[model samples]
Target chain A: MLKPDLLIVGAGPAGMSAAVVAARAGLSVMVVDEQPTPGGQIWRGIEANAGTARGRALGAPYLSGLATVRAFRESGAVYWPSTRVWQIEPTLRTYVTGPDGTLMIQPSAILIATGAQERPAPFRGWTLPGVMTVGAAQILLKAPGTVPAAPVWIAGCGPLALLYAHQLVRLGGAVAGFLDTRMPAPLAGAARLAAGAVLRSGRELAKGAYWYADLHRRAGRYVRGVVDLQALGTDRVEGVRYRTADGRVEEVETSLLLIHEGVVPELHTARSLGCQTRWHAGQAAYVPVLNEWGESSVPGILVAGDAAGIGGAEAAIQRGRLAALRILSRLGRLPAGQEGAEAACRKALARALAPRAFLDRIFMPRENVFLPDDDTIVCRCEELRVRDLRGALSCSVGANQLKAFTRAGMGPCQGRQCAYTVASLIANVEARPMGDVEPFRVRPPLKPVRLCDVASLAEEAAPP
Target chain B: MFRLLEQGRSGEDAVTIDLDGQPVRARAGETVASVLMREAEAWCRATPVSQARRAPYCMMGVCFDCLMLVEGEGLLRACQTYVRDGMKIRRQIGARHVVPSC
Candidate 1:
């Protein structure tokens, strides 16, 4: 059981940044990631796939991770790649299953930068074979250079969806149509926020504008103000049907349907560790409550990156550096006075996060996406539909009790895919704040662990 | 079904694996779901109750729809598992094992 001063859970932009900063400051750091590489989903396979034509087609934001990853590799941090952290105890003991076997480590401080996940927006026929998330499509392209067969249709509203469409077109993949669900109503503060973004982070604004312009020019069948969207198929997706704001229903033929409604913090690991979270209205998700320096309600356990909230990769990196500096200061490793540096970091983080409110306003997912029809399957693991959940809701408002009755969130995923949708539906039906609906209590083995592996743990235990 | 862009591919070593008793070729670093999709095998597993077909929807391991039976491994996620030489895999039919009476 080798212990380190700081144990970082992810090797994304945030975790990698923290490792580099802390290790450079003479603090021992250990970073663990499930992927074989350091880059989280955003920069996945960056080392192996970055130089390819498809990678270049992904644009500047995707390529920007190369320098961060290179710095982390040279920081002399102990990186455990292809490792899965199954449980985190309050005593700072983290249990992980890696290439060797099950092992545990005790770190003085823990930082969870596990990152974000695409929000689960269930709709009719979503379980069909050819239906997948836009993030998933991006993953295939980023990792393996694979593209869905021709006649692919993308749906939903978010920057990621548009980015994926732009990348796909750049890669010579055909997009049959794109259904944008953003309502046309003007956002109250969008203009002011956009201006602030341009003033503060001109490079990011310009990059985003470039992507938007490229997508607009390449994608021909782009429709806005879409509603009542549904994938049409029995065994596999064959087409998509949606109603436009102009009050006309249209169906487009397609073999693959990619959907996205933005992303939310992946909260199972944070919640399982008993970190207090607050419902964020802007992102419509529950974000872990963290102080200015990224420390959670529970001392010694910090959260950064999109896991802390919906901040993008750049903000994640800034937040990670800030957390590392605070840890160093708390450990008496910092010099007598470096307030200026600390203040500069804080200001940079603020600038990085300045544009999020405007983006959230523009890309907010429509209410109907989460509020599925009675027949639409809400829980993919248990195959529980909205009607089944509504039946459970009639008897109780608590998500845990509803789980007991209908087994909505009790499957292998442990509510990762359906918890948000279930919680939102319960809150809407019970006429209570979304926060009032309690999240499912996540237990050990956060990831699916084989029974054999668990049983063999005793043989590989480190001697005291 | 999907295919990789010729110029974007890594040119990784190719390996052959058994898929439902048939030999299928896959790249060394490619996932089982990627190989399946390349071969036009859309349905990965079937639902327990109705035996309805399902495929890899998330492809990032969140969706359990891509569950498949690996030789000696019982059941594993096709999207999560990388392809290996001589690997034996089969489409997971409706519930293969039932819970015994308590």
Candidate 2:
């Protein structure tokens, strides 16, 4: 087996950008991504979809990924797609399963840019066939150029949902309605944030305005300040019911229900690697703690992109470059006194994240969004409901104990979909902070692996 | 059930797969869940305990609701697995049992 100087875990903006910089600096870099292509979720399938008319119709911001992906491809970095990293040992060794079989790589340094995932928001009938997260719907449109069935009802708050609705409408898909759960309270310091955003990145503000206007133009029934939202269906989603700000209950008949409540850093791999984490109130999730250069508490390992915090794609790219620069300096490839360059990258990252505070304030998920109804399924894997979790919580105080009492996070996902909800529910019941409630322990084979693959691992090992 | 936006716009090669001994039209790069969504009956399987019909919810691999039997691969995620010609897929009825080989 071959060991590389640095191993980049994701192919998103952060990981690819880091690879480009590190490989250009004459360092041996290996980039591994689960997807067959380099683009991670945000830029997924950019290599295959770019320059196509359908891709262009996805809008300008999405097309910007073309240049970064192309640069990574041309950087001479070793690229391995269709590879899943099942485990990363504390000793900086990564175990991955590829087309052939399981392989191990011991890199001198590791960069985990695993990025973000849609925050799980459970509701009545959410497990029904037609209900999916807004991110999932966007993936269908971005990758396969497919749209959900018409009479689609989009619910929840955040920029992603609005952007998806706008893209769907632009792609000639009709949305039946939208349910905005953002509270009616005016965001404080909005003028200041707007000024900062415009001064820093005018193009981003303009793009957001365009998407908003496009969605607004095609809007059918826009319900704001909605509460008690539920997807009503026996077999599949037949309709959605919600209460308006005026306390009026309304129901919209729709075949598809797309829900979003923002995204949080995907922390399973990081937590499994024993990296330090802290609860971020602004993002309403636990984020891996990292230094200015994206280095985690675990030495020789770095965390960047939305994995560190929700700073969007541009900030992720800048953070990736910053981490690469630090790595280059540590490897003695770059000059020692590069404070000026580092400062510039920091400034760019700040500008990129300028609009985040304002956006987070307005789009902060309401309290009810996290606390599911008694009947709502909290754990998608185990089919555990809020009432079930509450029953377990009466006797259990920690997440691990509750997991034992009522198989909440022990399913195929390994707590990916239910960890936050379980922890939040535990916190609510115990009257403790979310941070105090321990997250579920992550085991090897982060994703489910076939037993045959495990048994064939010895035969697939490469000659030393 | 959901359908593609249009024919050529999907930019995917066409392929056919067998779903429970029936032919289903699907694109080469499309997932099994995509094909199931386009069908009249969108559901892929029923839950083991309650026998409740379930379809692909997250579309991504996380939700685990889109499990199906693909070519004797036992239960696999329909959303993650891409379609191929002559692929034999069956609806996952309940709990999956891995039969041991001698």
Candidate 3:
């Protein structure tokens, strides 16, 4: 068994930033990530794409990750890429499986920076091939530098979807159409949010405006206030059907359909550790309850980045640095009166998150889209439909109870794909606040591992 | 369903991996999901529960929609697994068979 003074899960912007700080502070840091490379989803393949034309096309924000990744490599922190931490015991004994099978890690403190994932939304024919999230499409462009051969239709709303459509247009790729699903907010409320956005995040708002204009100019067709969206196909996605603002249904033929509402913090690792979480209504996801230092309710466990909330990469980096400072102070490695540095990080984090409320207000997912049609498959892994879940909800009151009654959240994904939808269904039926509806209890062996891998871990534990 | 961009396809070595009974070329750093998506028929596996054809939805490791079988391993996530030369890949048709460790 190997021991590190600080164990950081994920190698994203947050985790990487924290590792650099903690390791520089003389702590033995081990950063583990499931991806094959260092950059997480936001900066996937950043190292390879840094100086290339593709990176330039991705803009300055993406290339900024190269310096962070380079510093992390030279930080004296041990990074174990492709290592999946399936279990983190109550004793903070972490179990991971990688090239050498399973290994146990004992660490003094654990930081979870697992980051955010695209919110999984279910609709008619979503299970069909060729339908994927806008985030997935971005990964393809970033990693393999691939783009769809034919014109692809993009549906849904948010800065990400707009940004991706703009990126594809910049790449000289074809866009069949864009279906914007953002619901209209009240004029007074929207004006208040827009004023704040203009004042606090003018540059970010300018970038978003540029993307919107570019996509609108380039897209073959653009429709706003779209609802009742569904992929129409047999075996694979053949076309898209959506209801426009005027309640008129429109259909467009396309081989590919990319959808996105927004992202939610990935909570499997943190949840399994029994960290306290509360539902964020605007983001429509459960985020861990963390203190100012990024430490969770469970002492010694810290959460940073989007895992704590929907703060983007910039906020995540500052939060990571703040967490590292706190951990160093706890370890007695830092002298007192470091309040200046701490205050700086806090101010930067606040500035980075200033426009979040405005963005959330504008891009909040449509209420109708949250609850799928009865026939739609909500649980992708279990092939369970909304009707199936509704039948179970008659007897079940919460997510865990519904899982037992319908087996919706027991699949390989462990409810990552269906938890949001399942919780929504239960709340709608039980007539309770979404916060009151409990999510599935995340257990160890979070990712599926082979029996042989478990046996190898046991062998490693045995005395020689 | 996908093609590589000329500007971004910089100095990367290409390797051939066996898909079913046929050989397919893939870039050195590309994952199995990326390689598979290049095919016109991009479906990677059939769902174990419904035998419904499925393709990789999330290129990241979260969604298990891209589960495929390698030469010796049980089902592995295609999006997470990098493509290696001569690696025997097969679409998981149904439930994975129980592999005895004894």
Candidate 4:
């Protein structure tokens, strides 16, 4: 058993930020990350130590990850790279797989800074190899700086979808079209998004207006509504069938289809700890219920970042540090000043996430988050379609039940993309709350690496 | 949070803002965010994630809309660090995807 003063579960901005702060304050800190490097998914550090230009160019601002890596090395922070942490106990203990094998770890305090997973909305022929989430696409670029240039169509809602499209266009990838998952008129729900827009800095508003104007100017329209993805080639995507809001369907040929619809925090660990949770209507998922200090209702345990809710990395980083300060204070590692520090962090958290919160609510999944078309495939692996899912819904079955019937959410991506669509469709069809549908437990590798690579960690279950 | 000048706070070395294409003199005690916001490039990064008109929604790096392609670096969290002289800070709207995933 390895013991430390602080055991950080992720090495992303949140976990690393927490580790840096706490370690600087003189506590022994240990950070275990599944990836070979410390930056996690948002800031994937290049391994070969080559410092390739690939990461520098595409990753943009996160390139400064080198500095953070340097800091960790200097601080003597115990960073177990390539360590897949499978189980996080309620007592804030953890079991992880290191290079040699699985190991149990006990810490004085633990920070659950595990981040979020992108939501997957289904379309026809989406099961094809070339069709992947924007997150997955970004990872490809991050790891080896590889951007597939074969006519990509980025589809779905939220910032990520646009971000991917914008990047793809710049990187010589021919973007057949940029599809915003929301309706063009945006429905009445757009008012909420406009409200969120009100708080944005003037520059951003100007940029947005410019983009909108540019879209109207160039394409004579903005991209909106659902699209039917198809494999134009043998193994990859060849084109897409775009259906506008009024319901005009157009076939567009493409080599790749990058889809993303915001994201939800990875909540399995929180659930495993038996933490009280509430459904965030905006995020369309259940998140650990945390307090102002980022503390879970479960006394010693604290939560931060997307795990608490789908706040971005900046919010997660701040919350992680603040949570640490509070936990340290509570554990008697630090002096009084707990109240003041917590107050400050809370203020920062609110201000940082406020703008996004508004947008999140506006872009919140609707009753038809996945009004899957009649022939749209619901399960990518099994190639199950809406008809199959409808049968399950008619029977009043849930994601798990449907999985048993159709294997919709049990594929390699672990239903990361299909689960929500399935649950939402089920909920909408059944006229039940999303909470009733419940979330499927997430087991490791939270990220699906090669089976051979994950051999060591495979022994440890994520403890659903 | 403090990536832009108006949003920057005093006494904290949060961001490094370049002045007229030249890096300003920022000490460790002051936050790079504060100093960068004071510089001409106050509109450090764009906000797609945070929905902020300006970037650095969390000022901590979680809300990554404030990402900038700095000189000698690809992207850095402007709100998280203090300013440094001669530092090349470039704004990153988005970057071109390179290479292919194996």
Candidate 5:
């Protein structure tokens, strides 16, 4: 059996940061990812050089990481993209593919930097072809230099939504309005936890207000604030019904609907290893529970990045470096010249962990906004209606109980395509908070592999 | 599902448009997207969902973010066609309110 000094799952900021530190410290490191590229969703810098004007405007912070990513690549750490880690056992797990083909290995340490996902906005016709996520829109702009040429309207809340609007303007696209989804400052108190993090609430809020002003000037007379996005178009999105705060309705017929709530860390792989978990009130999702040192309950396995919780790219990278430092310390390599490195890493990690107050308030998923109307398709996969979720609620069923009964998440994408939608439906129908609802339990084969390859596993077991 | 549609040969003459009354250069066979991209138009479309303003997604016919209004109608994909001379091309904001006539 082959064993390395470290095995990292995911190639985002966190995973790459950890690998760089550990490898530089003379530890063998290997990174495996399911996509063709390394930068996670937030930073999908396509290599074609078909850069957009907005991408150029978003500037260095979004673009600078690639330099670090390039350094990680040249450092000789193994890079395995487009390879899915089907099963991860306590010590060693065999997979049908590596950078080129399937291999098995044991590692002294495992760092998971699996990152975040944008929350779903399940309003009427949101699933239609014209609708997409804010992050997804940025992706379309970056990868293909494409943005809707028609006057596009932006909705939802969060710093990202506005960022997209500004980027659209920078790209020469006209915008209609910025629907502020910020919960009226009264419903709930900011979690004290958000205040205690690395960044100050004042700074984050200031940044958001700055962008809104910039957008206001750039999109003169067009930027309207609304509370609800009623149905958009008839079939594929010809227009949208936006409800103003005064209870008046304005309808704009546009072909696209770019929406998002906020990002939630994808925790499937971390959970597959049985990392201890805790529910994040802000994200409204469960995250792999890890200690200050980034160690999971299982020895040799560590969690970092948004997978630990959405701390942003800077925090994710520092946390990744911290995990490597912890691993090196355990190997009796610390307490010397490494002290300088250790302090630097921890402080960098500190900066990365933004103050939670504003972020917490910014992220907490709304229980009411975009609530699925009756007849709106809740589960995009099975075309399950909101009525179906309501039916389950009448029988006193919840997300977990209903999953086994309805096979909502049994499709090949393995809940990636359906779980959140289902969870939200149940939450809406039952009049409960998302935190109160149980999330889908993630199993192995994080990516779907051919069944034949999965069945031939016995012949591919580890070497004696 | 993703078929690449390449642009054909350039037309013989420069077709023009009064973009908000300023003469803009376009081509006979070029899409509003191709013309705008070759010159000024970059942000093509936005969605009705989150309002994360976006350009037309999937330059192929898949995502309909490239739609623009042609003579009061708002269902044309900018990336999928040619522009005619003197055509009124306005950036699509949303649908105009239609009232029922007595």
Candidate 6:
């Protein structure tokens, strides 16, 4: 068993930044992440690849993460790499499993920086091989410096989609085409957000503009307002079909199909800890309710980074620092009113999050995404189709009830991939507000734990 | 279906791992899912419910779509598991056969 003043349950931008701040302030900090290295999905494998040719090609945004990773390594915080924090009890006793086996830790405070997962974009033949999320492809490129040999046809629309397309081109990978599924936002609403973004987040806006221009310059076919997207294949994705903006359905041959519709805060860890959350209509996801200090509804528990909302890495780092300052003050590590960095962190965080509203409005998921066709597999883990869920919707009122009736979310994934879609379907059928359809009730053993691991913990606790 | 970029092929040591009783070469630091993606048969598992073939969706841990039987031990997420020298990997079909707890 281990005891630390604070236990952070991820090693991403937020977790690493938080560990650095808290440890420097004389609070014993420990970060446990499931990756082999400290860089979470944002920097993925920065330590090994940061100064290499691959890093230079990955561009500035990724290279900027090297400094943070270096600071975290030198910060005296204990980092347990390749460790999974499967459960956190209300008592603040945390259980984690790793290469060494299972262990328990009791921490004074817990910070969940688990971050975000791509919004599940289910469509026909999505389960086939060679079809994956754009984020997955980026991870592959970062860690292993690999790319699909076949030209990739990217679908859906978001900043990540364009950024990845540009990165793929930069890495000498060919893009078969880009099928943009974004619908034009109302000019008034979009303009209002754009004005704020330009005023506060001009740098981020400039970067997106660069990627957009580079992608258009390099991509062969750029199809906008794409609808009814589907991958075509028997064993693996061999082609894709989608209706173009001009109302013509086009089919293109491509072995790889990448999709993205932005990311939503990962909710299992927060939900399991019984934190309160509400649906964010703008991002179209459930985000945990948190104060400016990053403290959640539950005292002694804080959430930072994309796990709280869809703020990207820069904002996540700022939030992590802000959370650490609050934790430090709460624990008396810092004398009262000496927290001078809080103001700077808040300003940087606001600026980092400025572009989000405009991006969210412009890249919001199209209406068709929520209404996956009857034949589409809503639950990839349970292999449940939309029709199967619809059959159970009549007898169910919400996501939890639908799960009990159809077992749509009862597989190894525990509903990470399907919860949003299932809840959306239930909301549409039940004619209830999206917020009324609560997500699945997350249980303990957040990650699948081996029975032997649990038994080992029990034996260790026995009187010797 | 996937190939290592220029930097991936240089400097990194290569190791061979067995995939479904066949030998395949892989980079040392690359994950089992990355190695499997380069193989012709990319699907690593058949769903327990429908027995339909599935491959790695999210290269991260959240999506358990990359489950594979390694060394006949149990089903492990290939995306999370790194490729090692002579790691015996097999496509996990249907429900995982539970190994007895000792």
The candidate scoring highest on DockQ is 6
TM-score of chain B of 1: 0.85
Chain A TM-scores, one per candidate? 0.96, 0.95, 0.98, 0.83, 0.87, 0.98
Ranking by lDDT: 6, 3, 1, 2, 5, 4
Give the TM-scores of the predictions, in the order they appear. Answer: 0.95, 0.95, 0.97, 0.70, 0.75, 0.97
Candidate 5 residue A207 Cα shift, in angstroms, is 4.1
lDDT of 5 by residue, A167-213 (tens): 67766666755555555544345545544542444665566667788
Off by over 4 Å in 4: A46-73, A184-197, A203-222, A225-234, A297-299, A336-340, A365-367, A381-383, A398-414, A441-464, B1-102
lDDT of 3: 0.88
Residues B1-102, model 3: lDDT tens digits:
788886334536468899988898888888999989889779988888989999999888888899998887768899999988898899989787777523
Q: What is the interface RMSD of each candidate, in Å?
A: 3.1, 2.1, 1.6, 17.2, 12.3, 1.3
Per-residue lDDT of model 1, residues A102-201, tens digit only: 7878999999999998899999889888888999888889877888778578888888987888888888897777788887647557778777777877
DockQ values for all predictions?
0.54, 0.61, 0.74, 0.02, 0.03, 0.79
Q: Residues A424-464, candidate 6, lDDT per residue (tens digit)?
A: 89889988878888789986679878788898898779989
TM-score of chain B of each: 0.85, 0.88, 0.88, 0.53, 0.65, 0.88
For model 6, the superposed segments whose C-alpha errors exceed 4 Å read A335-337, B7-11
Better candidate number, 2 or 3, judged by TM-score: 3
Candidate closer to the true structure by DockQ (higher is better), 2 or 4 = 2
lDDT of 3 at B74: 66
Q: On a 0 to 1 TM-score scale, where does candidate 2 land against the true structure?
A: 0.95
Candidate 6 residue pairs in backbone clash? none
Error of 3 at A218 (Å): 0.6
Candidate 1 vs candidate 5, TM-score winner: 1
All candidates' lDDT scores?
0.84, 0.84, 0.88, 0.61, 0.64, 0.88
Per-prediction tally of clashes: 0, 0, 0, 44, 42, 0
